[model samples]
Target chain A: MAKVLMKGNEAIGAAAIKAGCKYFFGYPITPQNELPEYMARELPNIGGVFLQAESEVAAINMVYGAAGAGARVMTSSSSPGIALKQEGISYIAGAELPCVIVNIVRGGPGLGGIQPAQSDYYQATRGGGNGDYRHLVYAPATIQETVDLLMEAFDVAEQYRNPVMVIGDGMIGQMMEPVEFKEPKKRPIAPKTWSTDGTKGERKPNIINSLYIDPQELEDHVIRLENKYAEMKENETRYENYNVKDADVVVVAYGTTSRVVKNAIAKCEEEGIKIGLIRPITLWPFPDKAFEEITDRTKGILTVEMSTGQMIDDVKIAINGRKPVHFYGRTGGMVPIPDAIVEEIKKISGGVK
Target chain B: MLKDNRIRVITGHYGSGKTEFAVNYAVKLAGVNKKVAIVDLDVVNPYFRSREKEGFLSDLGIRVIGSSIKGASSDLPAISGEVLTPLQDETFEAVLDVGGDPIGARSLGRYHEYFQKGKYDMLFVINANRFETQTKEKTIAYLKNIEVQSRAKVTGLINNTHLLRSTTIEDVLRGQELCKEVSEELNVPIRYVSCIENVAKELPKDIEGEIFPIKMYMREDWMS
Candidate 1:
C-alpha cells in the first residue's frame, strides 16, 4: 500500500477498522474529536456501529456492553474526557473484557488546556479507576508506531482479555505524517469463549460480571488479575535504547516528548556530549529492563516530559537509584523544545567530566 | 511569474498546505524586495501555524503578525489589530494565512470590510491527498463553504498536494488533475502549482499555473 499523509487521530481510527473493530463509542473533545468523527463517517459504510454517547461515562459503559458481547470495540477521548471513563475502564478490567481505549492527552489536572501534553502519565499507566487492576498502556512516539500499535492493540487486548490504552499527546493527533498501513505481527489471541454472547440453548451461557459477593472469591479474582498483569510484564514490556551502550548521560522520554529528546540527542552529539536515550514504548510495563542496557560508564539518567514531573518516578523506580535521576519538564500545555532539552543534557554532561 | 496582488489571502481545507503556501508566497515576494507582511489568521489549529515561523520570517525582513498575545504558546482565538496595518497599507504586500475549513475561515470574515474595499486575491489551496478535498464535488463544496464563511469569493486555485517530505512527482500531477477539474467546474483559474523544488522541476512545462518551487518551511526535519 502507498504511504498516505494522515493525522494521528484519523490514522488510529483507520487502524481500528483495519483490525476488524466493529463498534465505536466516544464523545467529542479537542485533539481527539477527529477520531470519533472519522469512525462516525467510515464505520457505517463498512456495516459497523458508531455511537456518539451522550457523555464519556455513557460511552465507556457502552464499550463495556459491546466488549462483553464479544465484539472488537473502541472508545477515544482527550484528557478530561478520558478521566470520565476511568471507572468504566476499571469495571471492564474486572470483567476481563477486551477493548481499546485511546487517550490523546492534553495538559490537565482538570481542564488545563487544549495543547500537547503528557500529564496523564499516571492516569494511563497507574489505573485511574479503583481496585487493584492493570491494563497494557502503549505510549507510541510516532504516528507510524501509533498505527502499528493500534492494529496490534486489539490483538493484545483480546489475548490478555484486558483493556489496552494507547496514549499519545495532542501533537500526535494534530501532526501530519506519511504512514503506510502495514500489518502488525499477530499475537496468539484465543477465542472469546469467555464473552457473554448468547449460548443458543445448546451450551452453558458465559457470564460477564465484576461483582464478587464472596470475600475470598473477590481476593481470588484480584490475584488472578495480578497474575495476568505479571504475564503482561513478562511478555509485553517494550522500550527503545538509542546509543545507550556507552554514554555519559541517558535521557528517558516517551510519546511526543521523546521526539523532542531525539533532536536534543543529535545536538548533544554535534557538541561531543555523548547523550543516549531510553524511550519506553509501554508505560505500564515500564520497561525496567531498558535501564540495564545503560552502560555503567553513564553518569546519570535525565527524564524529560511535557508534565512538570510524572514519568520521572517510573524512571527512578526502574533504575532503583542505580544512577542519579534528574528531571526536566514543562507543564500546563507547554511542550519542551529541543534546545531546552539540549541545555538540560549539557548541564548533566558538564558534571560528568 | 505569479500575479503580484497586493493582498494574497490563502484558504484551504485542513492539511491542504495553506500555511505552507502562504509562507512560501510571502518569502518569494520578499525575495524580489517587495515589502511583504504576513497575517496569521489561523486560530483553529494550535500547531503548524504561520505564527510559529514568525522569528524566521522576521529575520528575513518580513513582518509576521499573529494574535494580540505575543506569546507563541498562547492558543486563544484572538486576532491582533496589527493585521489591519498590512491590509490598509498599500505599500506593504500582505499575505494572509487563514485557517483550514470554513470554521477556520470565519476568522477571515472579520476583515471582510477591508478586503471588500481593496483589490485582493483569495486563493483556495487544494491538496488532492487530503481526504476532505479529494473529489471535484468535495473540493467545490469546500470552496463554496469557505466563501460563505469568509464572505469572500475564491479568486484562484493553488495545487499544493503533498505528503510532507515523501511527496512524489506523481502526487503533484495527480493533484493537478483534480485542481483542473475543480477549476473548470467553478471557473476559478489555477494560479499556482506549488511543490518542493525537485518535484516542481519534474513537472511538465505544459501544466496549468506557474510552478512555484517551495521549501519545506513549515515541516521540521524530524517530522519526515
Candidate 2:
C-alpha cells in the first residue's frame, strides 16, 4: 500500500494485520491505546478476532491459548500492564508457544507516569516472567521501524517456537510518522504438527505443558532453551552503527532516544568532535559484535537512555573495561533533548571522568 | 497579524490539530513583531498541549501563559494569572488554544464578559480525516455543540484536513467541499485551507480557499 501517516500504535496494528495476525488480545492503556482501538474497529470486518480482555493478564493467556491452537496471536500493553502479563508470558515461554507481545513502555516503577520511557530495557531483555528462559526483544527507533520489527517479530517467534517481545516507549507509540507497509513476505513456517488444535482421533493427544516433575526432563528443557538462545545470539543479533568507523566517543542508545542522539551527533560533528551512535535494534541479542568494530580512535562510550542508567549496564558489560563508559539519562518520563545529549558528548570528550 | 480579530480562539474536535495550528499561528504573529500571548486553555489532553512548547515559544519573544506548574501533566484547568492579560491589553494579539470538544470549551463561558467587548474570532479547525466530524453534517453538529458550551459565536472555519503523511492535494480538495457545505449552511467564512508547507508547495493549483502553509515545530522524537 501507499505510505500512510500513522501513529506508532496504529501502524503496529496495521502491520500485525498485514503479517497475517488475525487474533489480537489487548487492554486499554495510554500511549498505546490506538493499537487496540485500531484492532477493535478493523479486525472484525476482516474476518478476524479482536477481543479486549478483562485485564492484561487475561489478554496474554488468551494469546497463549490461541498460539497453542496454531493461530497467530498477539497481545499488547504499556509498562504496568506488561508487568501484569509477565506471568502469562513466562507460562507461554515455558510452554514454547509462538506468539507476539508488544510493550509500548511508559514511565514506571509503579504507575510512575504516562509519558514515554525506556525503563523496561532490563525487563524486556531479562524476560519479565520467571524462568531460565530468554525471548528475542526488538527495540524500534521509528514508527516505520516499529512496523517492520513487529512484522518480523511474529516470524521470529514462530521460527524459534518462542514468544517475542516488540518494545517501544510512549513516544514511539504516540508519535505520527510516515510509514510504508511493504507487501508481507511469505514466511516459511514449520507446520504445526505439534499443535493441540485437534488430533482428529489420529494419534496420541499432544500435550503442551510447562511443568516438569522430573528433574532430568526440566534440565533437558533448560538446555534446549539455552541452545536456542545461543543460536539466536549467533544469528539474530541486530544493530545499526552510524559514523563509528573513526570516532573518538561512541554514543549508545535505542528506540526514540536514539533519534535525539542522532541529532546530538550531528551537532557534535560540526564542532569538530567525532561522535558515533550504536543503536541496538534487537535489545535481546544486545549486538555484542557491534562493540568489536569500535575502532582504536574511540576513547570512551556514553550510553544515553530515557531511564536512569539501565542500558548502561549492558554497554559496560559489552565493553568489558576496555574503555570507561559514561551514562547520561533522564528518568520518570523526562525525554532527553538533542542539546543535552550534545552537551553530554562535549563532557565525554573533555575528560569528565 | 489577524486582520479582523485581535483575540482569536482556535477550537475543534479531538485530533484536528487545533493546538498545532495555534502554536504555528502565534509563532507567525510573533515573528512579525505583533505582540503575541498564547493562553493554553486545554485541560483535556495531557499530551501535545501548546504549554509543553512554552520554553521554545518564550525564546521567540512570544508570551506563553499556561498552567502555574511548568510541564504539568494534570488535566485540571488551573488558570494562570497571566491568562487574563490578553483581555485587558489590546496591543497583545492573544490566541486561546481551547481544549477539544464541548467539555473543553466550557471554560470559555468564564471568559464570556471579555469576549463581548474584545474583537474575537472563534475559528473552528476542521479535519475531514477524523472519524467524529468526517462528514459535513457531523462538522456542523460539532460546531453547534462547541458554540453552545462556550456561549460564543464561531465566526470562521479553518480547514486543516489531513491524514498526516498520506494527505494529498485531493484530500485538501475533498475537505474544501466539506467546508463549502458547512460555510453555506452555517454562514461562517472559510479562513484558510492548511496543509504542511511541503505538500502546499506541491499542490496542482485546482483547489479553493487561501492556503495557510504550516510548518510544525512540535514533533515526534524521531522527527528531530
**Could you report the DockQ of all the candidates, in the order they appear?**
0.45, 0.27
| Candidate 2 lDDT over residue span A1-353, tens digit each | 54545668878998999898999998888768778988998899889999999988889989989999989999999999999999998998899999999998888899778788999998998877898999899999988888988998888899889999999998888776667877645566788888898899997888888999999999999999999989989988999998887788999999989999998888877788889889999999898888987877787899999998888988988989988999999988888999988887888788333
Cα deviation of B222, candidate 2, in Å: 6.1
- lDDT by residue for model 2 (B1-224), tens: 45848889999986687988899999889888888999999866556789889889999998998887665545456878778898679888999999888888998888887776348989999987765677888899999999999999998898888876567877777778899899999988888788898878876565555678887766754472
Q: On residues A1-353, what C-alpha lDDT tens digit does candidate 1 reach at each position?
A: 86777889889988999999989999998878779988998999999999999999999999999999999999999999999999999999999999999999988888878888999999998878999999999999989999999999999999999999999999999898877788878689888778778888968988889999999999999999999999999999999999988899999999888888999888888778888899999999999998888878888899999998899999999899789999999988787889988888878778334
**What value of lDDT does candidate 1 attain over all alpha carbons?**
0.90
Compose the digit string of candidate 1's lDDT tens values, residues B74-165: 67789998999999998999999998889999998888886753388899999988877879999999999999999998888999999987
Best by TM-score: 1
Judged by lDDT against the true structure, how good is candidate 2?
A: 0.85
Query: How displaced is residue B218 in candidate 2, in Å?
Result: 1.6
The global C-alpha lDDT for each of the candidates, from Candidate 1 onward, is 0.90, 0.85
- Where model 1 places Cα greater than 4 Å from the true spot, the runs are A351-353, B30-37, B53-92, B106-118, B134-141, B144-151, B184-187, B197-207
